[model samples]
Target: MTKEENLEKMRHSTSHVMAEAVQSLFTGVRFGIGPAIEDGFYYDFELARPLTPEDLPAIENKIREIVDADYPFIREEVDKEEARQLFADQPYKLELIDEFPDNRVTIYKQGSFADLCRGPHVASTSEIKAFKLTHIAGAYWRGDERSPMLQRIYGVAFDSEAELEGYLARQAEAMKRDHRKLGKELDIFSIHEEIGPGLVCWHPRGALIRQIIEDFWKAEHIKRGYDIVYTPHIAKLALWKTSGHWDFYRDYLYSPIEVEGQEYILRPMNCLGHILIYNSQLRSYRDLPLRYAELGTVYRYERTGVLHGMARVRGFTQDDAHIFCRPDQIEAEVAGVLKLAQLMMSTFGFNDYELLLSTRPERYVGSIQMWDEATDSLATVLEKLELPYDLDPGEGVFYGPKIDIKLRDALGHAWQGPTIQVDFNLPERFDVCYIGDDGAEHPVVMIHRTVLGSMERFVACLTEHYGGVFPVWLSPLQVVIIPIADRHVDYAQQIKNELEEEAIRSRVDERAERMSWKIREAQLQKIPYMLIVGDKEVESSNVSLRLRSGEDVGMRSLLQVKSLIKAVIEARAQTALEGESI
Candidate 1:
């Protein structure tokens, strides 16, 4: 067999080995479809007993034992009736058999297990090695949530041990940077079961950071000629119908609420609202490139089981905007949006990003020429910016072609952000228009773009990216004044007041604990500076700086300390808070 055929057979055979091993270990574990994914394969099963983390090792051992026995994977093609009889006890396999052609069906037999499958498996089970079952989760049969919840045993098969180890190590590192753990540790945000899932309640510390980010975002948008706008959280259902969101995208949207018999749907997107604002006025050639921005909060329907901490949520605020530009300005507007996304993300210490440009999908509504033009425009912008990107064929939304940017965190996990999408359907449906210099009304080209994705998800990503070690500018408490003794309380308060007057977020820790304990608490809170003011500092009119890392930076004036912090904050510098870089 050719190398391509051999690799396919290898992965296919590994699935059988995994299934055989599971069946041997658990007497009544019914099988489901097991297919090879991009990096690995997974099998679904309906277990008589729910398997926990403890059951993994034994199942793995059984799989290895099966491989060691070197069972030959014999393939046979039989008529549909024979296949059905062979898999009589397995309903899921029998379902496949019923769907198969009446002419013939293939089955693979290994050891005591014979499964109804389409063959091209490896010759023997001994060829299966360098594989692992990475995770176990509950999945709905055939991805329909109403169907039976089956046990999904996810595993990875690699060509070598080194590759397997590398994948495992990356997963371990991702766990270390898991945002839920870091969010609590850093006191960023939380979702209480009592308050319900998919909703975030930001604590004071977290809200302060978000405000800082929003302030920066607003200032940048202003500088880039974007008009800030606000709209109602709930809009008339008639508006959604006009935008076509009610028809095509309503499944992912929240149900409408009736107020006095008028259906009002919670806005799932800011695009339609912004389009309404654009259509509120007749546009001329001079107003061809109007940009509107808003930190718009939106609601979408996400099932309870799929809701994650911050990353996936039912209600979230998006850093959303819409660009109403002429067809001739499409390329420049796309490039401008791309530049803005990079600038904002990089300030938050996200420098590496992967760009994906998705072209028209099979069921797209726009004409082929329009799709080609929009895609070519985006490609031109990418090329002009000298950015490397991948083309995702037939992945664009039904409305238009688009660009997606995925940012890499410190742990090397990619999070989706900064999407730019061209929309022909919305403008056509809304009948948005702009008049040219020649006095002819034309269809406006609307581009929907988002930077930082959503506030909740962005905060989660930032928490994990920095590992909770936020920069001085983003840190909730930039400075904490820790008095060595009760006698120094006056001096600490004085310094705190001075720092506060300078707009520095400084606080005085007045707890009756010992000096060492106060310092430790400040460090634990990840405060950037622990200003230790005591007799020496009072006498010298200077404060001894206990850097967050516990290093004594000798003595510096209160002014000098403020200057150091201001420099770091202004630069938005990212460094180990405890180390030489600070």
Candidate 2:
């Protein structure tokens, strides 16, 4: 076999070894399915007792024993009736056998165990060299919630010990960068059990950071000739029906509530609201390219097992906007939005992104010509920008084609953040129009775009990217004043007041704790700068500025410090403005 084919066979064989190990440890543990994933493999089992971390070692040891035995994996073809009878005790396996209309079926056997799987396993168990079970979780049988629950053991295996060691080290490093832990450690945000899952409660510090981000977004949108707007969170169900969301997306949305005789729903998107705003007024070609921006909050129904911190949540706020333009202007508008998305992402220190342009799906709503036009607009923009992107056939939304941008995180993990989509269905449904150059009414083209796709996911990405050490301009507490002694309190308070007056967030550590303890607290909070006020510095009417790293920059005048911070903020703003133009 070729090297690549051998690796696939080895991965498949490892699954059998894991299954044998599970059967040895847990008697009467019925198996579901074992399959290879991107990096490794996993097996699901319906065990009598819940499996924990302590059970992994015993199971792994059994797998090692099986490997030492060097059991040969033999494949054989069997008739459908014979296969069904052989796997009668295993209902799930029997069901698999029943699904095959053909009489012939492939089965693999090792030692005393046999599985009804298509055979492409390694020659023997000894070839499975390095492996480790990663985690334990509950998975529904066949991914159906109404089905039986199974205990899933997720693990990764490699051909060599060196590869396994490297994988483990990378996993450890990623755990350190997990955003949920960092968010709590930095006191940025929290999700209380009492408040329910998939919902976030932004604390005081986190709220401040969110506000700063929103303000910057508003400023940039205004400069780009985009109008900011807001709408109600709950709307009549008839509005969604008119927009087709009630039919296509009702399952992912919360159940409606009755208000008098009308049913209302908490919106899962802001598109309908923006469409209403457009329908509110008649327009001409002169009013084309009308861009509306909103940091609109939305709620969606998420399965319980899928919720993971801020990345996957039921409630989130999107930095969303919709642009209404003429068909001829679609290319320029799409290019502009792409430039805007790149700017917003790069401003947050994301330089590398994976771009995907998805085409029409099988069940798409628009005409072939409309789909072709929408796809061409995005493609043309990418060509003009000289950007390398992947084209995915039959992967777009039912309404239109889209461009998805996934930002690479610190650990080389990709997070989907930005997206730009074209829509033809909404215009037709809403009957929106504009006066063309010929003075004839024509349907307008609409583009939906979001830079930070969802605020909750964006914050999670930022938390992991910075490792809780946010940049100066984005830091919740930009500076903290730590007075070394009671005598320095007056000067420290005065400096803090001045900074506050200048709209630079500053706080005085007026606690009875020692200066060292106070500084440590500030560091723990990840404050960007710590200003120390001692008697000598107070006498000189200057403050000693200490960075988060503990390096002191002597002493500088109050105005000088203010000017320095102002310059830093201005530089960031300039870079941000440049990034938006891209």
What's the lDDT for residue 452 in model 2?
79
Candidate 1 overall lDDT versus native? 0.86
lDDT of 2 by residue, 254-335 (tens): 8999989999999998988898899898889999889999999999988897787888899999999999999989888888
Q: After aligning candidate 1 to the native by TM-score, how far in Å is the CA of 388 from where it should be? A: 1.6
Q: What value does the lDDT take at residue 267 in candidate 1?
A: 91
Q: lDDT tens digits, residues 1-582, model 1?
A: 786566667777777788888898888778998877655778899989998988878888988899899999998889988887878888888888878756698888998788888777887888886888878999888899788999988888877799889988987877767778777877878998897779898989999999999999999999999999998999999998888888887888888899998999999898887888998888998987999999999998877777878888989999999999999999989999999998988899877678999999998887899999999999999999999999999999899999998866545657778899999998888888899988999999999999889888888888877767688889998888988888989999999889888788988888899989888778877787888888999999999887776678879998888888777778777852324564
Runs of candidate 2 with Cα error greater than 4 angstroms are 1-11, 26-32, 46-50, 72-124, 140-150, 158-173, 192-196, 407-415, 539-542, 550-564, 573-582
Prediction RMSDs, each to the true structure = 4.2, 4.3
